[model samples]
Target: MNDITISNNPDRERFEVSVAGKVIGKAWYKAYDGDGQAERIFYHTVVNEEYAGQGLAGRLAKAALDETVAAGLGIVPVCPFIKSYITGHPEYEASTVAITPAHLQFLDKALAARA
Candidate 1:
């Protein structure tokens, strides 16, 4: 097994998974500032095709969630991968928040701004 590592890239707003110093997967998130708290909305997760079935995605998700919880932020799992991952991991329930319509609206604006 290669030395798999994961780190949060705040500038990209994603958690990156790397192997042997090469990034091969990422879990993208957006932040929604509300009520003096930051909610991290995980909207997309992707692992390189060559790295599929290696559990890197799960590792990446865990790292991202860990960092968010550690930072005292909420986790809004808008991505199916993240939502399902949290469902199977009850430990994250405390930090997880269900996605709302407002979240979708916010994402639309964020993505559009980037485009």
Candidate 2:
């Protein structure tokens, strides 16, 4: 496995992926208060074009989601890539929350644009 380093840059509201100290990918999210609990809505994930097909996005997602769980925050995966990732990884299911209609609407537009 590659020595991919994942860190939450709360100052920037994103989780960054670095290899050899070079940033190559990031998963962005917005933090909100969900009924008195901290919640994170993952809106986007992007890996450098040159790093495509190397599964760095998956690594980023796993690290981000794990950190969210560790912090006791819920996850709302509005980003298609993140939704797909969590769907296929049952172990992370416990940390996920149901998407709201508003979030769904946003996701529809966001994902459609990507398609």
Candidate 3:
């Protein structure tokens, strides 16, 4: 397995995963203020097609969520990929917030389609 490097690009509001100096995946998020606290809303996650099925997306998602937690920010997993990931990994649940019923519905459909 290639050594993947995950880094936060604050200017772009995204976390990126790179292998051999080439970007293979990214998780985009937006930062906002809510209830007198900082929050992060993950909206999209993408791994390069060539890098698909290599676990890059999961690595990127973990890195992004870890960063959010480190920053003391709540998370809203609007992105289906992220929602699905967090569902399987409940350890990150403490940092998650603002997940609506619609998000769960989307995740259920997405999970079913994947199955």
For each candidate, how many residue pairs have backbone atoms clashing (under 3 Å)?
A: 0, 0, 0
Tens digits of lDDT, candidate 1, 26-87: 99999888567789999999999999998989999999999999999999998999999999
Clashes of 3: 0
**lDDT, each prediction:** 0.92, 0.87, 0.84
Candidate with maximal TM-score: 1
List the candidate numbers ranked by lDDT, top first: 1, 2, 3
User: Which tens-of-lDDT digit does each residue in 1-115 have in candidate 2?
Assistant: 4677899999888999998889899998877666677788898999999999988999899999999989999999988899999999988788898888866566567558756
What TM-score would each prediction reach against the true structure?
Answer: 0.95, 0.83, 0.82
Which candidate has the top score in lDDT? 1
Cα RMSD for predicted model 3: 6.9
Worst 10 residues of 3 by lDDT: 102-111
Error of 1 at 97 (Å): 1.2
